[model samples]
Target chain A: MTSVEHSPLTRKLSAFVALTKAELAVLDRLHKRRRIFRAGHDMVHQGQSAQTAFILYEGWVCSYKLQADGTRQIVDVQVPGDFLGLRSVLLRTSDHSFEPIVDIEAVEVRASDLLEAFAQTPRLATAILWAASRDEAMVVEHLVGIGRRDADVRMAHFLLELGARLALVGMGRAEGFDCPLTQYHLADTLGLSAVHVNRTLRQLRERGLVTFRDGHVRFHDHQGLVDLAEFDPAYLDQTGPLLT
Target chain B: MTSVEHSPLTRKLSAFVALTKAELAVLDRLHKRRRIFRAGHDMVHQGQSAQTAFILYEGWVCSYKLQADGTRQIVDVQVPGDFLGLRSVLLRTSDHSFEPIVDIEAVEVRASDLLEAFAQTPRLATAILWAASRDEAMVVEHLVGIGRRDADVRMAHFLLELGARLALVGMGRAEGFDCPLTQYHLADTLGLSAVHVNRTLRQLRERGLVTFRDGHVRFHDHQGLVDLAEFDPAYLDQTGPLLT
Candidate 1:
């Protein structure tokens, strides 16, 4: 395939469309190439309309909401092959913000264009619907993590889940992964203090459950970490494509 | 209409069917009317197949899950004209339990049946997709309530949202409503102690915001309560028929 066909936006959609053989031509036509943003650039604002959906090709981004008191809640991390701005498409409004954590290259697809394609292809529509459900389930799991689970369990589950998702998209290695997420972002996500997050990471590394350094994580005993987190992957059953 | 035509289950389905005529016939055939235990009976267990989706026709129900230590978290409250078991419908497995809060009459639709209807009707499929999305937004709001809002604000938002949803299906009065939920259930839902819930209710009544007695609640100053809770009705949009 030509480099144009192998672009990150196309790569992301193709990964999905390859499973279902659903219509991608419309999306391909609507695709317009956009440049990379430097680290610390804002991709989406909390209260503004994020009219574009993005597929992260390189680098990382954080979805978060800021409070009036200068506090922030980091909601989710967008990685390669992951599309952010999906939840906003349904609401026709944006309720969160996205900021690039590193120099980022991503593909942006207009919501209207995607909806138009969905209107034409039932299979594509089904796939998109399933993706949205999977996204919501992730949020629910996060709620369960923060509301009920202890801090250690929450962090372990987050790492395990992230590794699994990234591996599925061929972004992570089998036993370890590249996650350029800072302890500050992780703390915001788990509703803990940054100091607490740093301490937890140190403990994990000391105990050999996982080791984090140089923007990479090594899962020394994946099953042990899962057992500690009580992590079950059943909540994420985006299996419709596989089933068909 | 004849009495059979006006059956509670039939009436509820018809109201939902009014919005999706094509999908209604498909759903009607798959729907089975069954009477299980009366008020306070568990409809579905956690970690089960989640084979059936219930549409409440009379009385109320709730969805909840428990931690390993036996602490319960009430996820959602279901009343007449509402579709219970929606989360499990997509997940294909019940991660939560469903129980009727009062003497309940409902129709159970199998998941395979709903999926068939979704495959056949475009509008219905779109509505269901939107229904799931709307449920997600509610979950997000709940997270905010649990993590950020005060006790009184959380309770007020819950009551007003429930009132608006129930009123849509002709189950509530102009200024009040009958929900049949217990203080314990309310406490679990709000993540507050029972004593705290009681005190908050007393405060609400004393402030002329709301009045509750005998499972019925009356809003003294609905707008005032809305203002206090910062309740936005956009989260409860009824653009769809049954699930919304």
Candidate 2:
């Protein structure tokens, strides 16, 4: 583990503090700086005690669950400035697993520290709970997508959503954002076959709606993709100076 | 329209206020009491502008989403004092519809009323938002149920969950609750055919696990249902008296 002097860790904590300054400062002070992980590493395991919650400083992480048969469902993907393990934090039990998808760095705060901070700052409690609520809502929207929408629409909707979220955190460029995700990951998230994900991605690229290579994606026609996906960001309810 | 002068209404409001006093009071003041509807009336429609949220004062309601092809998924059933339209309130649009299963009395608060109240009380705001968050999270759990668990397990899980929620608001008795529902309704909720629901209900009955007929259900062996469903109430997170 290194000190919080590093750029990635500093920037991420500052972003969370921007959302709830005084409270997150309490969290930031309690956090112990942790070493960066390589592209593939498990931060938490399913059914195990969730000891800490992470604020993703740099790179991506995924929250997922696995079946007895070894099949996995990627419940969510966490990017920079996103809060991980908030659901488990409230539940007092871990329901999913977390894995870093790229070279990763984060500040890990103990559950006790989080509970102490929540006890002191009601606003932070509200913010974290709201964050968890929004996370669950995203899962609801995804359920609707997979249960009802056609495959093409589902894939397009996912890409559009990823682009929007990444753009909000300044990780995205003018055209698109780095995907930094594989077809296998997309398959697990969307509940599709890996081959189907690959084909869909190819279709998206061939239509000139998006471009992706080497883990980076560039939207050639962002509005077109939005239309194709029938995407509307309204449910996100982006509010206040905090999320901004 | 009339005042909430009836005992049932008062009792239902009490449960809500018990969990969220001043906030529910603000909400209670907003409603102009309305007549209970017959079994078939639609409370809200999918893809429609949702004007208000409702709390069941007596009887039951069902929340459901309809497909483009007209297939319906009855996601959750609302018992006495249960919350509905909160999802629509949060999203600013209704993506599903609801209807009374019987003649049902309810208190309705306009979304404006809720927003105004939130503006005044941060604690109330947190409570309502947390309530909505729980609703949204239940929908996610439903997704997991259908996507992963088998039919019998799903049915058992659904019953266990409903019973718990009903118990929370005092609709359920110590041992079991009056079922207050039909096989068809359970079928729709579980994404199964009515015949399948009937068969599963029979299975639970014959195994000395449950008893149901004539709008009443008793858990003959409550632990059996728990084991059958792999039921876990951790997801409910029904803690904290601040917001009930």
Candidate 3:
């Protein structure tokens, strides 16, 4: 927590917003009470009333919604610098569950503390709002992929988007970075069957566009994947006033 | 525009956050520069760089993301009181398009004006942010429905949600409400084939759960449909802090 410059959250927000020194210090101050939850256990459940969220510092987590039919849809995957259960802080109950992909580090954030931060630094508040809007846009993009894009395009877009997001936080680059999502995870995310996900991954590998295998995503032809996925990172990196 | 007491935006946000008279006045003041938009035309197209949003005063509009393959996914169907393109004002370029379902009345909003309003009334700003969070939750719910729920449940949940949303605006009720969407729109929203949407509607009607026909949604067995859809509206109506 000492190296504010090394903070992925700071780096991500700073991409679009220039934070003042005091704002960076205030952001640094929010890193108290770091906690770790073991992988394979949900830290939050749907309908669980709460007013706390987490700022991920390491590892990966996913938010998912479970259905009455015993099936679950992975809504979003969280990485370092991402906020987990942020919407829950504003709403009475958490509408989804979060399961860590690995034993990870995070800082618990109270709603009051966040509001106090907003009061102290309006610019920081706007930057955080921009971050939230960016997260919402990513979900919207995912919804579009699920509703309209074919499996190939969907997989390609998902991977490329993740890569771009990670790059902003210094966790990944075009050649790719480590990944932990299994085929089942891909199935739940892409709205495809596990078999379908498996086939799609094989197809992408055959096409030499991207590869998601054994805890990594290696981009063979990043440009080719981008073209096929129609990937546009403008929403993620827009220089709109709030975004700035 | 004088009916501050009857403004649907006010009504919807007031359900979650009580607005003082001053907040209401500020909200009312945002309604200048009223304009009319025709149906069957896009006021906002995907990737358009802009800084203006609109507050819908009347009629329905749908936002959609088009794919390279000529197919489009209807992301959200907005009604009176909804802020169309609000997200676009934050992100430099809109990632989707907006098409009015009918001739509509709306007020234009610029980014700077909105920021000024937020600065004037922080509580009101929180309320509006609550509204945005509610919208994001709806999309997440739709993502879950499309990824995990069966066709019948998806359709039932979607219709019930729309009904609940419209009810807040005093435009709908428990028994039924007028709708302008076609089977094709349902297909896009639910990520199903149009034939599948048709079959599901027929099935629900035959089962006496609900009926969506000829531009209307009638709740034949409202409770039964809710049971079928497993609709828990906590996310939409949470009593959390920002909500208050």
Instruction: Write the residue-wise lDDT of candidate 2 on A1-244 in tens digits.
Output: 2333333433433332344456546555655655577777787776566645777778899888776657777877898767766555434455678899988887676655654655465445444544554565567667666556677888888888887667656677768787779889998888889999888889988998987678888889989998888787644444333322
Q: Which pairs of residues collide in candidate 3? A: none
Candidate 1 accuracy as lDDT: 0.70
> Which residue pairs show backbone clashes in model 1?
B39-B102
**Model 2, clash count?**
0
Cα lDDT of model 2 by residue, B1-244, tens digit: 3443333434433332343455445555655655576787898887666756777777899887665567677767777656666655544456568889988887776655654655555555444444554565567667666566777888888888887777666678757888778888887776679899889888888888877788877888888899888777765655434223
CA lDDT of B74 in candidate 3? 88
| Selected candidate, larger lDDT, 1 vs 3 | 3
Question: How well is each residue in B1-244 modelled by candidate 3, as lDDT tens digits?
Answer: 7656678788887876777888888888887778899999999999998778999989999999987778888888999989898878777788779999889988898877776777677666666666787888999998888777889999999999998899888899889999999898889889999999989999999999988878989999999999999999888863323434
lDDT of 1 by residue, A1-244 (tens): 1233544444434433453333545445544555587889788786565556776777788887665557777767777656676655544456668899999887777655664665566555555555566667677677777778788888999998888777656677868998888888898888889899999889988888998788889999888898899887766653333324
Model 1 TM-score is 0.82
**DockQ-derived CAPRI band for the predicted complex in model 2:** incorrect
Off by over 4 Å in 2: A1-57, A103-133, A202-213, A218-229, A238-244, B1-40, B44-52, B109-133, B180-184, B193-213, B238-244
User: What DockQ values do the models have?
Assistant: 0.27, 0.20, 0.58
> After superposition, which runs of candidate 1 have C-alpha atoms over 4 Å from their true positions?
A1-42, A47-59, A67-70, A81-83, A103-120, A238-242, B1-37, B110-112, B238-244
In terms of TM-score, which candidate is stronger, 2 or 3?
A: 3
Winner on TM-score (1 vs 3): 3
lDDT of each: 0.70, 0.67, 0.84
**CAPRI band for model 3:** medium
